[model samples]
Target: MSDRQTSRAGMALALAFFSGMLSSSLPTPLYPVYISLYGFSASQIMAVFGVYAAGVLFALAFTAKVHIRTSLYTRPLYAGLTCVLLSSLLMMFADNFMILILGRFVTGLGSGILMAYINRSLIKLFDTEVSNTAALTASASLILGQAIGPLITGEIVHRGFYALKTPYIILFILVVMSIFGIWRSRLVINRHCTTVTIERKSVGAQSYRGLCFRDVIVCCMAIFLSWAMASTFISQGPTLARSYFNVASVQLVSYSLSAFLLVAGISQIVMRKKHHYSSLKIGVVAQLAAVLLALSSVHTKAPSLLFISVMLEGFAYGAILVGAATIVNMVARQSQQHHLINLLYIVGYVGNWLPFSLSVMMDHFTQETALNAYLILCSILSTCIFLSAYFAVRCQNITGRIRKN
Candidate 1:
């Protein structure tokens, strides 16, 4: 393929990936609507939210062992897009809770496949800096889709439009357009240069084995924690906010969640020049602070404090995501890049799954108390994880010096 053709295909692939992620989170703001309409308990709502993560995990596990031809990314890309389109349609017409859950699960599966492939292709096709740029571009697109879904959905619902169905209808249109773009651009890569060959040249056998100690493990843990915090806020924050602040407006809830995601995307772009480690440190500290503010906001019933916490959480989300991806890029061999990315996502989505337990907690305790306890636990655990990563890196550096001496 020509250079121009490759670039166009690459861009189209990224947009398709974005569309998938957007579809995955499109139902976030509508959880309350569903609860009202269906009389869903907290457990049922969380079940609906967590099912998507389960789909992501299943896709990642299945793809980890397989070697997908880069040239064939478009086939699965469209298939995933079609799945998302079907999911949106199901959500639009669903009268039963089971159907809604099914829609979310399908959306998750579609997003998981597309995200893994897009990240793999971008890293394989480009150089370090170029791939990193592309990765961030794709990540930002994911965040943008996430932000836009809730923001638009809330507006539609608040304005008394088709409410639950309008968001999916609009999403249906976007997916169709994305599919056409991928088809028209002929988004295929050169299969002759496989990721496996690149991996062999990038890292030797011993260095590859040592990945468990240095970069991949730590980055994965950081990503897990980051996504845990983020998913809690995105998936459950609206429910908690309504319970605490008597927030009845869907638009406000949507704006609040979108603000967190928008800040995350913008912060990543603005601080694109910083080192990954530095970003991780700053992000962890911000998350700790956000947790404290979140606790205070719940106690005092202060929206202002909650807003501050949201912004801090955004910083944390952006930093950890970029940091984790950069670390994997720095440490993994070329061939392992795609698989490692998939693994990292798997870990991250596990965090998303963790918040679902709050439904059980809320059953026994007040909403404020249960949420506060969860936030505190996450903060303390995140700090410990950060410290562990720090000491591990320090020990590795010391061992390196001893070997040199």
Candidate 2:
């Protein structure tokens, strides 16, 4: 295929990937609407969110060992897109909590599968430099979709509270278009007769045990901490905004969420040149600052401070995620890279699940108090991540010196 053709095909696949992620978060600003309309409690609302994480976990654990085949990416991609379409329809028509959970769970499952497929396909399609570019583009697309989901949904929901289905309708149409885009791109690639081959299926038994490596553990922890903080805001921010700041407007909720991802994406792009460990440390510090500001916001009930906290959280997310991926790639065996990445995401989604469990606090304490507790938890996790990275870097240096001696 020509360079231009490959780029275009890459962009098309990127869009499809973005569409799936966008649908995943399209409900961020609408959780309040669900509570009001479906008469669900905060805990139940969180359970619905948790179901999505559960679906992701289900996919990760079960599919981690699947062999990668070139002709296979489209199947999961198509299946995931279909699951997202079904999810949108169910959510649009949902009148009960059960249906809502089902919808979110299916969407999570779809996204989990697609997320794994797309990353592997990138390796099949491009060289290291080109694949890295495509990977960053896809990552940014995922963040952009997360940002756009709330912004668009916020506007729809705020304009007419009863019109909460508008965002799903829009998402449904986009999903359909994305599915078609993928189909067309696939046809184009096939027409070129560009065949993808898996030279070897497994790296080796030794690299399979590479999961026990200390640096790998630290990178996985980094992914978990980064995503855990991001999920906290998405799952609980709306309720906190309404209860604490009296800013119940869906638009503000959506915009704040959007700002978190937008800033994070930009941070990743701007700091792409920095050393991975340096970026990880700074990211951890930024997350700590976010938690501190969050505690202050809870006390002062300052919306601006809350917004600033979210922005800092975004910066931290971008840094830690990129840093973790880079560090893992540096240490991962070539043939075992896919397995290592799967492990990272499995841990990451577990981080996503933890914050949603915080909804139990709603029964015992005020929302502000519960949120303050959540921020404290995030602070502790951030500190652990920083220390882990510090020691991992130290170990890497000591090992290098030992080799020299």
Candidate 3:
């Protein structure tokens, strides 16, 4: 395939990836809106969010057992896009909690499939030097799409537009456009590649028993922590922000969440050339600082401090995500690449639901108490992640020296 053709295919893939991620998070800022409209409790809304993560895990598990020809790479992409479209369609007319939950779950299914396939597809389409760039592109597109989705919806809803229906309509349209782009590109699949299959293995016990096991564990932990932090913010940050600032504007909440994700996206691009270890170190520190700021902001009711906290959280999220993904790419064998990536995501999505427990805690405890518990939990996890990363880097350096000798 020609360079131009490859570039076009990569672009098409990125668009699809971005669209799928955007659709998955499009409802973040609208959770409060749903509560008000449907008269549901916060725990129920959190359940809706948890259901989406469940869908993602289900898709990952289901896809892990199938083998597809390399030439038909677009098949998963098409299947994912169709699921996303269905999600939007369901959300557009959703008037009750169950429908919203169903919509979010379908969107999760689409996102999981796209996330599993997009990076691998990009790697196949580009040479080694360009493959790194492709990976960065995929990561940035994912973060940016997530960032923009809520911003767009929040703005539209704030402007007295069709608060509930307009965002999904736009999402539906975007998914359709993404489908067209993929169809039109006629993506030339890499024929030299063998069948793409995800090996079925116990990712926890058996899979982590080699020389590179420590590195794999660290990478998995990093992704899990990073995504867990991001999901907590997506699922509850808006309401928390409102409580801290004593305001109730959806746009404000959306803007704050978008800012967090936008900075995360930009940080990924800026730190793309750095060593994965350095990125992980920086991310660990930033995450700790962000948690400190969040604790302070909550106590002092300082909006500025809260926004700063949000930005730091975003940086931590992006840096950790990129570092973990790079490490996984380096350590995973070609045949086991899909399996490892799926494992990473499965861990991360499970973390996605960790915050749901906080909502349940709020039922029994004060919001402040729940918030403190959650932040403290995050701090503890962040420390563990840092230790894991430190040892992983040490292991890798030792292995490299042994290889050279």
Candidate 4:
């Protein structure tokens, strides 16, 4: 392919990849809408959310190794796209709670598979070694798509809440557009193929036995902590909006989330330029600040203050995530890169699910008090992340994502 042709194809591939990864979070602001329509509880919402994570977990447990080694990205891409299509179909048809979980699970599985494939494939697409570009693109694709998805999805849902069919109709349209991108991308990439092998996949046997399980777990604490804090925002922010502001607007929820997500995405781009950004210090201070800001918002009960605080906290969270992902990529072998990424994603989703569910249990308390409790918990978890990044990451050895392991 000529340079001009390759550039055009690359843009198309990027669109498909971005579309696939993004649809996972398009429903983020719409969950409350779903609850209103289905008359489901928050715990039920957690279960439904958990199904998204679970779908990813199931794919990791079985398909991670198979897909990465095969060098055939299109087959999995098509399968994942099919799964996404099915999810929208199911949501349109679903009446009961079981079907809700089924839709989320399908969406989650597609997201999980697409994420692993796209992140890894980027390295191959440009004939470049694994570096922050792939990761930066990955982070951008996720945060931006998520940021935009809710804003767009919420608008459709806002309209549908009155008429009652717009949310499904919008999602159905998104899924179809996503499929077109995936199909066109497969053709684009194949024509300009620059196939390569991942080095880590060739590691000798019994190596995992030598990796100090205790230390590796310790090393991973930052990743998990980052997720826990991130999840708290996602799972509770809408509910808090309801309590403190009497927010009935789905668009309000969408706009608020879009603000936080915007800050988060912009932070990653900002960190990309800082060659010497401190992972440990940044992660630690940001979380500490987030906790204080959160605690204050509860006492004050000001939505403006709360929005500013969440945006600040979100900026910090975005930095921590990019840093943590960078660390994971740096620490693991090339072959192990996808595995470690899978693990990081798992921890992140676990953080995403558990606290929200726990908050549901705590929903019995007054909303203000419940908000306060989660703020304290999130602060502590964030502190743990800070401490790990501080101790484990340094300029000497961990210059960037490509570690010397």
Candidate 5:
């Protein structure tokens, strides 16, 4: 393929990725709406949101190896897109909590399958080693889609349109457009011609030797902490905004969530040229600052502080995610990239469920107490990530000097 063709294909894949992620979070701002419509408790609504993670985990477990064995990226892409389309239909017509849960679970499945292949597909299509450009493209697409979904949905719903149905309808159309784009890019037909065969010569065993287990653990922890914070905001931020800040407008709440994620994506773009360890350090500091800001926002009920905290959280999320992904790409061999990436996501997805589990605490404790507990947990995790990353960087520098000597 020519350079132009490859770039076009990459864009098409990015759209598909973006659309998938957008669908995953499309219902975020609508959780309160669901509670009002269905007369469900907050915990029940959180359960609906949390089930999506379960679907993602299931899809990752089964579909992570499909592309390696068949060398057909388009097949899984088609399957994932089909799942997203089905999910939209379910969500559009959903009238009950069960239907919402089912819709989100299916959305999770589609996202999981897409996430498993999209990065590797970009690397293969660009015909390059795992590079920062590819990492940025993949990370930025995922975060931006997540950021934009809620804003669009919230705006439409706030306008008193078909609040529940219209957003999913838009999602369905976006998925259809992405499917067409992927086909037009010839990724569908080219799947048959391009065969990526992993040699069966214990490459996996050798791959482990080159990787630093400590670094891998830190990367996984970084993503886990990042997503944990992001998911908490998405699932519960609106309620908090309305209750604490008296920001009663759904559109305003959506704006706050979107602002957080938008900064995250933008931060990744800004730090794309920086070293991975440096990015991690910046992310750690931002996370700690955000945590402090969050506690203060809750205490004073300051809307401005809440917004600032949200943005800081976003910056931390983006920097940590990009840094972790780039480090994984740098350390893992080509053949084992998917396995390691899948593992990383598995850990991160687990974090998606962490906030919802706090619903149990909210049942027994005051909202302030439960939230403070969660924030404290985030602070501890941030510190651990900082220390681990610092040590890993020191170890790498020492090894480099030894090699030179």
Candidate 6:
């Protein structure tokens, strides 16, 4: 392929990846709508929300690790299109709660598989100079798709469109367009690259043998904290919005989410172009600010305040993920690429996955009490991550000194 041709195909592949991700979270704002449409209580809605994560987890365990299937990624742009079509059709049957849950699970499955494939594919498409650029694009695509998915759906729903099935109808069209995108672009199916190696090189073989103590406890807490706090709005936002502020429409909540995602997506471009430290420093500051805003919303009970806080948190979350992924991707060896990718996503997804479940568990508590408890737990976790990064930095400094000595 010519240089220009390869670049074009790569970008198209990224676009395809981005669209698939949108389907993963498109149902976010509509959970309340589904609950009302099918007469499900909060617990049932939470259970259904958790089911999407479960589907992804099962795919990660079984499907993602297989070597043979990956050769089909560009072609399975077909599979993604097919799944989106079926998942959308499934939503048409979502007159009941069970169908809503079923459609979401299938939707999650399609997107989850696509996520791993896209990350790996983009990494291969570019050299190191533009590797981070590709990663940023991948990251931005994720932020954009997830951010926009609900907003678009919400707008259609706000306009008196089909209530339960409307988002799916809209999404069906996007997926179809993405299929055409696949056709217009020449996608190379590289047969040589197979599945992620079970054993990573360069990192001590012993290190690979077991999850280190720090990995299990400290790192786990850091992930949980970052994710729960970041995604708190997803599970509770709909109910909370409905109860206190009289925020009835799902589309509006979707917009609230889009606001944050939009900021994150736009900032990524700025980060790519400028490549400055100010953004990194500001991202840390944003995390601190997000915590404060979250606490403030708890006191004011102003839904607007809470929504703003969620957006700020989303921005910080994006920055943190981008920074961390850059560090990991650099530090990990060539053969270890997929493992790093898998582990990072596993942590990131856990943030979304477990937090929703926890919000449900905490629903039995009073709203104020639940918010306080969740905030406190997450705060501790965030502090721990900052400290870990600090020590890791210090450790690197000391190692450098010793080597010089």
Q: Which stretches of candidate 1 lie over 4 Å from their true place?
A: 1-6, 31-45, 129-131, 185-191, 194-213, 239-254, 295-303, 330-332, 335-337, 366-372, 395-405
Give the 10-residue window scoring lowest on summed lDDT in candidate 2: 199-208
Compared with the true structure, all predictions reach lDDT values of 0.74, 0.73, 0.76, 0.63, 0.78, 0.62
Candidate 3 residue-wise lDDT, 1-405, digit = tens: 778887788888888989988987788768878888789896798688778888889988887777676677788989999999999999888888889889889998999898877766766665352135655767788887877887788788789698888988888888898888788765464345532233223222122223354666777777777787788777677777777577578677766777788889878887787766677678877887887887787778788887888889899888877766665654554335455666777887777777767888888998888878888888788888777767766775666676557
* 2 against 5, candidate with superior lDDT: 5
**Residue range 1-405, candidate 1, lDDT tens digits:** 666776776777777877888887677768888889889987798788778888878887877777777667667777788889999999999878799889888988888888777776666555443235655766777788777776677678779788988888888988898888788775354344444545545643222233343567777777787788788787677777787777778668767777888889977886567666667667777777887888888888987898788889898889878767766764644334468878888888777777867767898998877877887788788777778677765665666566557
Task: Please identify model 6 stretches exceeding 4 Å from their true place.
Answer: 32-37, 68-78, 164-166, 183-224, 238-256, 273-285, 296-308, 331-333, 353-365, 397-405
lDDT of 3 at 30: 83
lDDT of 4 by residue, 165-211 (tens): 45556656765776676566565455443433443244321212222
Order the candidate numbers by lDDT, best to worst.
Answer: 5, 3, 1, 2, 4, 6
Looking at model 4, residue 229 earns an lDDT score of 60
Question: Least accurate stretch of 10 residues (summed lDDT) in model 3?
Answer: 199-208
User: C-alpha displacement of 198 in model 1, angstroms?
Assistant: 10
TM-score of each: 0.83, 0.81, 0.86, 0.77, 0.86, 0.78
Clash pairs, candidate 3, are none
Cα-lDDT of candidate 6: 0.62
Model 6 lDDT, residue 345, Cα: 63
Instruction: Give the poorly placed runs of model 4, Cα more than 4 Å off.
Output: 1-13, 28-46, 127-131, 161-220, 241-254, 276-284, 299-305, 330-337, 357-373, 395-405
lDDT of 5 by residue, 1-405 (tens): 677777888888899999998998788768878878889896798688778988999998886565453356677788989999999999999988788889999999999988887766765564333246767888988888877887788788779798888989888998999899878876432543242234223333222233465677888988888888888887778877887579989778766776787789889988787867678778878987887898888778788898888899999999988888866664543445466777778998888777866667777888888878878877787877778877877777777666557
Q: By the lDDT metric, which is better: model 1 or model 2?
A: 1
Clashes of each: 1, 0, 0, 2, 0, 1
The alpha-carbon deviation from the true structure for residue 274 of candidate 6, after best TM-score superposition, in angstroms, is 7.0
Worst-scoring 10-residue span by lDDT in model 4: 204-213
Q: Model 5: clashing residue pairs?
A: none
